[model samples]
Target: MTEFKELYVRKGSVAQDYIDIAQDIYVEINNYFKIIDCNLKFCRMMNKPRTELFGTSILDAIHEKDKIKFQNIIRNALLKKFKDGIIRSDLVDYKSRIIATTMKLNPILDDNNNIVGMFVKFSSFRLRVEDSAVNTIFMSIYNSLTDLYTIYGTDTKIRINHVNTSLLNILGYTRDEMMGRHVADFLVKNKDQEENIKKLFKSLESTGNFTGEVLYQAKNGEEIPIHLSISSLVHNGKVIGSLGIGRDMREQKRLESENKSFELKLQNQSKLAEFGMMLQGVAHNMSTPLTGIKSSAQLQHSRLIKFKDKLAEKYGEDREISDNITDIMKFFELIDQSVSKLSKIIKNMMSKSRDQQSLSKEALNLAYVMNQEIEFLYANQFFKNRVEKNISIQPDLPVIYGLYSDFSQSFVNIIKNGVDAMWDSPVKKMDIVMYYESGAIFVKIKDTGKGIPHDIADKIFDPFFTTKPKFKDAKGEEPNGTGLGLDSVRSLLKPYRAKITFESGPGKGTEFIIAIPVKENQTDLNN
Candidate 1:
């Protein structure tokens, strides 16, 4: 520690001076606006360790009503749009008390002048009451920035009660056109987002605010991405409407997409490489239908030959050949089903080969997705009859949020593994049961086959570890099943706040249990 004066400075003396400014709240946030560090004063204000505050989204610190103002400030600074790179806004500490302050975003730039991180300075602390405080501070700095924030007020029922000039301009709608309209009227609804929005309203009622990102539809039907923070409005000590502050995120999302393109390309390539094995399953499955079709076709042809002779002998020249149409039609049904199965198998495999980055992370009906894959497996008549399947998925199961292909592939791997394990066992049965209770969803998939060996059970999830005989790939080089099925299953469940646990023994079959927090309790996972 060292002493300092206005004229004299020491190496560590100015660091404490920086903390003293703005009541000692200095923070650094990442590209996603998540806190990376804070000054000791800020730590005292937050009442939590630096470790606890790390990675906390900065959105949690800004008052909902002023978030749009804050976004404009940081965004302009990072993009170098502002000449001075300074703006004022409000911050909420851990106690939810608002503090008015001036903020500056010092961009951590790379060689190309692109922002990599942000060094934020907070000063001029005060008690924030309205958005006008921030507007007044920036009014002089940004003369032509009248439409930077889009603001609207929605009633308890979500009907738009008011819209600011910026809101009208951003949405291309007149005040008269939007007033009294439901907020969702301008939203392009995704699967189960309605449920999420309802949850947001509940959050606003309880916590007085909510912050998240969502998509809004412009007047011309273009989908526009937006980050929104909303606070509940009160009248006569009761909730009346919500005040929403939003900033368009189209450019941000586009840049992020551009940056991730190469990484996603590599990931998709790896998945395609892994798919070479699934193609083998497709070929192995085709054999069941092909063999059945061959025998049925041969017997039907022999019957037709005998029928043709009898008809020719009775009539002049087999005039109305109705000697055996019933059996022939049966053979046609078998042929038709076989061809359909073959087509589905090929389509499923080809789809897995393509990049799925464009696939939206929507709420998927787990039962529906699982049933589709089950039908694909049933295409192989040999495997279908050999295993007993009992699926008891609830009728109104809550949707799980994630990519459908991922979870579908996950179940296919487990079921396929169980089928393979039953090759030499007398009792081959698979049971799928699901239920929800106390804000948690439980799934049990039990297989009554030669269970996993007790000695190797712990190693089952290891990649490239398998006990089965190798099946040759298209190139005639056999790979040891790439044993990543269970590993991949665990990865797929993570986004849903779920985990898989298994119980297995040498002769006692295996049961894999999956548990996911109900949607109401779905936090700590990516949206």
Candidate 2:
């Protein structure tokens, strides 16, 4: 019979309907952190069979250093402030690899208000490591970049001064005793090596660097082998001093019976360059997949909207819930909105780092660009619940004839700096207002983040200067970043002939305003 066959078809289609609706939701698990449940997407992300994950504790897979943070997050879930709070952290897998993750924790309470469990809704983001990773990778990054350890000297007279605790412990010398002495005073001389040592010092003076094996007399009167490196410290175009890094070569000698001082420098530089390339690749990989995801969601939403229109036209009547057809149409519309929002976010993030193709000046809608930029800000994981925002643009704003990408880049950079400034603040909010006045377009951005200290206010715009801490991993080990972002902002605005200035009070907030002059003859309204 038709009725019996229809029932069978409905039952067969039930699982498909569930999958479609759950696509936007996250994978779930029980309170014990056992993998009692998961969606197909989460299973794919983990690349694990559901059966193998059934009895395993999620915490069991996390790195040891990060477990305490995870536990604190669990405890915070009990507090009302944090019950619905979003926690950003890294997740570890069976292979001991760290994966950056952002998730919201919703505590489930029972009839008596007893805490039962929690539901975690995971959000998608491209991860940026804040700490250094494991030993091998950390060592390569540590050596070639910045000097974390070893002895130091002044080139004026080679005075052994300003030694750090690390080198002090290694050399068995007190800082007070070494400060005034010439570096050569500590050298353990050989019968025939005095002339050779002088030649080596002279060679470095001319070349501005040295990397080689050397021997020095410890405070204990024992000769110690060292892998030494020294580079000129230039100031105002003069070599004011020399910075040196010396590693104890004993362990390396025991393994390879040779020094790798020069090789280490090369290796570090190579690793740093390779890592830079890897970051670019990661950006491409993340963006390409997200673009595809957005397209697919958009396609589905489009189809659903067409079907809803068909229903409206065929029925020719409006009734509340009307067999739930209207409800179904509304659901699809919501999905379309969400997917579109996510797509804008992804597009903004991807465009930020890519080399902006040169654009000739053209008329651009100022109001539209700001709204797009604000929506992109919401997509940022750091500002999800961390920062509040109020943005207002004057109605029917006059259009500006300029490089569109330039304004976009400049605005995004300011917004990003505002976000970074508030990282330590309790209340993080951004207020933005744009208006036309006095034949100029004015845009102001203000943040309730830690304001610029007077000392560094002068240097914030300097090339290669940044207050941003080095990007490290969960273990808190390595350093990363190029502090040229704001400098580029200044350069980006050159063609537009814009004037940018800011006001700051420590702990109060910082506000940056940009003003672009408009010609009186230029059109003020598109209409």
TM-score of each: 0.36, 0.38
lDDT of 2 by residue, 1-527 (tens): 23322322343376434533453224334556665544455555566876776666666645577678876776666554463345665666545667666776655565686655554545444332323355547545544442324334554535665565656666678879778677677778885357646765886768877777678788888777777777777778976677777777766664452124334434644664465456556766776676676666567667766766787789865665355665665675676577677555555555532322223565766776776667657766777676788888986677777665677768888888888788778998989899989887888999998899999988877655776666662234222334655666786676567888999989989999988777741543333
Model 2 weakest 10-residue run by lDDT: 1-10
* Tens-place lDDT digits, model 1, residues 435-490: 77676677778888688987888888755557765566423322235565776777
- The positional error of residue 274 in candidate 2, measured at the CA in angstroms, is 18
Score residue 351 of candidate 2 by CA lDDT: 55
- Candidate 2 versus truth, CA RMSD in Å, comes to 43.8
lDDT score for residue 63 of model 1: 81
RMSD after CA superposition, every candidate:
28.9, 43.8
